[model samples]
Target chain A: MATGEVKVLGSWSSPYVMRARIALHIKSVNYKFIEEKLSEGKSELLLKSNPVYKKIPVLIHGDKPVNESLIIIQYIDDTWPSAPSILPSDPYERAVARFWAAYLDEKWFPSVTSVGIADEEEAKKAGISQMEEGLALMEEAFGKCSKGKGFFGGDEIGFLDIAFGSFLGWLRVTEKINGIGLIDEAKTPALVSWAERFCSHAAVKDVMPDFDKLTEFGKMLFPKIRALAGTR
Target chain B: MATGEVKVLGSWSSPYVMRARIALHIKSVNYKFIEEKLSEGKSELLLKSNPVYKKIPVLIHGDKPVNESLIIIQYIDDTWPSAPSILPSDPYERAVARFWAAYLDEKWFPSVTSVGIADEEEAKKAGISQMEEGLALMEEAFGKCSKGKGFFGGDEIGFLDIAFGSFLGWLRVTEKINGIGLIDEAKTPALVSWAERFCSHAAVKDVMPDFDKLTEFGKMLFPKIRALAGTR
Candidate 1:
């Protein structure tokens, strides 16, 4: 029997949703996944629950919805502290992990979104440059943490690893959609290895959607997003 | 005597810096302040200490420098748990506080920055609209906690108050620089009261920079920022 029912209101194709799912699965927490059709506005439950964001990856535990993917992960960790700790215990390490997580949120997402909408050669160049800059920062940050450590917080998959895990999945699909190879095996070998290791983790592997499906969806959505941007 | 020597590397005009200063002050932590000139690039110590972000509001305890404003606030609260807790103990309430804090970082700042560059007439309209939306969201969040209490956390100033307090000061200055007012006493009575109450708090009042100087600096920098944006 489970302590309480955990429900996740999420869109099928959002990387943020994947983040929460991975954390819950890793912690061995039983959760019911609710796929929300975000294009059709949102459910009343979601709107009422997360009036501020009103977006998915809303984790409803004991009928309370916790919005924001990172916050949701932290909530899960705090609730199930005895289970696998997603964040490191040491304050410094935890801060570093959070910094990377935030970097991914702030820098990486925008760069990738740019890639998704790049039309002209110059636009593609600009987008690629931004993406490379973001990647370089991540590489340097991870290099600092790569000293005899299998994971970001060492010896185990922690917050940074989980945060980047979702990004790597999205990056792969993005590369396919954009027809750009930013993360080749030769380039960013450590990050490449880290991605491999992350996907192999049982918890992460279980929650991951089919890559082929994601690529198909990305291809279908790219034109729509570009059209929307053009209209704007 | 204190267990450790605290040092804060920050710029006087930065909202981010004010957050760290206010957090330390509220906790009654003894700390030295170093104001960095951000235009000349970061100092060697600042770069070395927070190589990742390479930005100010780096909280140095003994030797370790913790970068990022919100992260530093969390560290201060964790280090000095005996004092007024910056975040509520309840996981749900804490999550809500973190969500709003993150929302301010994610949505509010960008919207305000966008407003800053809009054409003079458009700037006022956009600035007022953006600030209104931000204030409305904040008003609801604060109102929820305002029941039977003076502060966001009910009794004493907490994380949400500190996070939002820094914004209030900047918003006021930015409103003056941009010549738009969204936080009038009649429009947002609760938020207006909160800002007045926050500014009057001894800890907040102690660390706040001279508002007139900040307004003058913002006026000076406005055209430069616009010129750079135009070129880009």
Candidate 2:
């Protein structure tokens, strides 16, 4: 049960950070979680561990630090080659999973995040529209990947599941603030169900941030996001 | 030795496509290379294989297709777990390689590409400055990664080597057209040497497109890139 000395440097609300935690939890890897107070300033350790990005969700196994959430998850899978694999065993399936995960981070997540931070109505509308299109594509992907199973990993949570599931908390907050069910049952029914199952899963249930708390956190952060948007 | 029936859908000019080719060559996997005539329009097979991105460098083994250059490289390593591994066997090393690869694609490549396409003097200057800064960082990275060895994989070409090396053809073209050595020996001596070794490596020598031909191709593409830049 003792899988090496693992440590995770993260912030409570970062979906990216949650990915590392969720993967560790699923792998049954005991790790010390160090919460970084990003609003104040990045810690020296975080800065040292990831000098290039200076970001969080850095997984330190022993003395070696692995940055980037998806890469960290892959590391977890590789380092601990056990059942409930984070990535698929088959090369083709693994590639497909990675592709979707990349799509979620690179394309879909941006549009969804923009919807929350955009000050202008036109920009927000555009963000929403794009987000909807991304979700529709994801809906089709889920049907293909899941093959009438409960999760993206088929029976249990896998790479793509954690990739998207980590963002569910923020999505919930987005829904509350925007007064729109972003993952509407009629639109993305499978994802709606998958979100519910993902949140309730043993490894995830405890790790997921409380809905009201995240909403409160979002309220404090939205102003800063809007200000950052203006400068860009 | 004959491996599985493998095929690579690619465009000759793409650095991404070259990553897959280089990895395959290193692995000694016999694969049919099908060039996608981008200007002529994407082939139906290319479009079907990679519906999500609709991009080149989709590796087909048997019937399953793996998209994305880095992912395809990982797939090659996974499917062919022999010596001369493309990715470092150690999990931490693999993560570090993946991080640098992502940085090359997402950050460094864009700045370098912008220098070639930017029409405005100020924009081109900005691109060059940023590209130089990126090269300087990469120079430091090569030192840490290579550890006094010949390449990023330390004596043999590996993931980060291919990750950065795939762009050497484009970099050479960029250098010729811009009239500046972006990877200058004065600025990044280690990279300058690494570039020489990488280009001449047996696996890479034939795979790397001819310099003059690529330069001519760049001249044809630069106008289109500038036009695209105007829209963005």
Could you say which candidate leads in lDDT?
A: 2
DockQ score for model 1, please?
0.42
Model 2 C-alpha lDDT per residue in residues B141-206, reported as the tens digit of each score:
898889899999998999999999999898889889989888877899999899999999999998
Q: Give the residue spans of candidate 1 off by over 4 A.
A: A1-4, A38-41, A177-181, B1-5, B38-41, B114-117, B174-181
**Residue A223 lDDT, candidate 2, scale 0-100:** 85
- TM-score of candidate 2 on Cα atoms, chains taken together: 0.94
Candidate maximizing DockQ: 2
| Each model's iRMS | 5.1, 4.6
Number of the top-ranking candidate, with TM-score as the measure: 2
Per-residue lDDT of candidate 2, residues A1-232 (tens digit) = 1246899999889999999999989999888999998767999999998988999889888778898999999999988888888898777778889999999999988987888888889999999898889889888989999999999999999999999999899888988999987798889999999999999999999889999999998988988888987889
User: What shift in Å separates residue A32 of candidate 1 from its native position after superposition?
Assistant: 1.1
